[model samples]
Target: MQWITIFKKEILEDWRNYKWIWVPLVFIVICIMDPISTYYLPQILESVGGMPEGTVLEPPEVVPSQAIMMSLTELSMLGVLVIVAISMSVIAGERKSGVAELILVKPVSYFTYISAKWAEKLLLVFTSYLIGMLASWYYVDLLFGQITAGQFFSLFFFYLIWLIFVISLTIFYNTIVKVPGLVLTLTVVTIMAMSAINQIFSYRMPWFPNSISGHITKMLMENSVPNALWGAVSITIILSVGLLIASNFILKTKEMAD
Candidate 1:
């Protein structure tokens, strides 16, 4: 019951602060841009009006999978920053402002409080992903090619796991470091480093959780996912669970800086 109350409070914060509005709008725009740009490259180039006379422009055919890939890539690049910005203040802001101190003096357990925050943020991420996915599929089919249900679900679930891992990491980092700016910087740097290391050791450590993007690209290209993805998924799930538990523990020791 207390957890639910705290979760609702988190949701209310999202609503009042307009985080729910702008975040999903950004995602929807990214989704729409993916297919629109792919299908209209020739026209877009012509509109630039710098082409030599009689230059033939043959636009490349864009596939549905390609649009999906572009959408997911945009999310990976831009969405992480957006999500981190919104989540950076979850605990740090409260602690810094003495809100955590006031609230902690009540009957609230730190575990329930942190769990509620994590759960609510997870739900928000899932909602945004759904909207982005549906919008991408609708436009991709209209502008590029038909996306079958099988293609959509296979890649979506696989990509979703990676996204969940990222959100968990953001929260875990938020709890560990109270400075919002440092939290954002460290989280982005860590994820980028993980991706690079995963690539450098691709053949050697195919089962590592950071190889998620490679698997996502392969699935988007309509290829059979390598058996290594299963291993990565397992590792990612364990890590995400550990992050939440660690966050819960860390939150208990926080003293309000204000």
Candidate 2:
């Protein structure tokens, strides 16, 4: 109940402070950009002498499921960037402004405060992904045809896993770095490192959340049930809990320099 109250307060604070604007804008842009690019790309290429003589450039045949997955991947990456930016500021901003001390003085424990913030951010990310998926559906329907519920849900679920992984990375960075800029830089570097490592070693490692999501998306698009779905789920669940535990531990031991 106390955590719920804290979570509610955090949501209200986000609304009041205009933190809700970025998610919608970022996701909407992703939704609109995907179909527009997929629809007019060949035409744009043709206009630019992209089709050479004797080389017929046929329009790329995009399956509805593939298009949805593609759009979801693009939007989800953007969501990762946005979430990292938001999470970088989550703790460091409060600490810089002396708000951390004020909040700590309240009845809230450090664990509650950290957990509430993460929960709020995760909810916001999920909402953003949902809006982006809906927008993609509308655009795809207008351009192509209606997609199946299975297709939509599968793609959405894949992206949701990606989002959770990104959020976990962000929270991990937030706990380690006290400056927003440093946290953001570290988060990006961490993401890149993970991607590189995953490329080098294509296993279902717990550290490679983004890659796991991509594999899941590929599985859905190819209409193949991933053999490692259970493994990925287990990784996600374990990593999420691990991140929450680490964040709480750091918050509990952190000293207020103010």
Candidate 2 lDDT score at position 81: 79
lDDT (10s digit) by residue, model 2, range 197-251: 8777766464456566666666766776575655665677688778878988987
What are the clashing pairs of model 1? none
TM-score of each: 0.94, 0.87
Q: Give the winner by lDDT.
A: 1
Candidate 1: misplaced stretches above 4 Å? 222-224
lDDT of 1: 0.82
Per-residue lDDT of candidate 1, residues 1-258 (tens digit): 899999999999999998788878887886677677878888999999899999888868666788778888888888777777778888777776678778888898888887789888888887888788889988888877888888888877887888888888888888887778888898899888988898899899987777876777776675677677878888899999999899888877765553
Model 2 vs truth, CA RMSD: 2.7
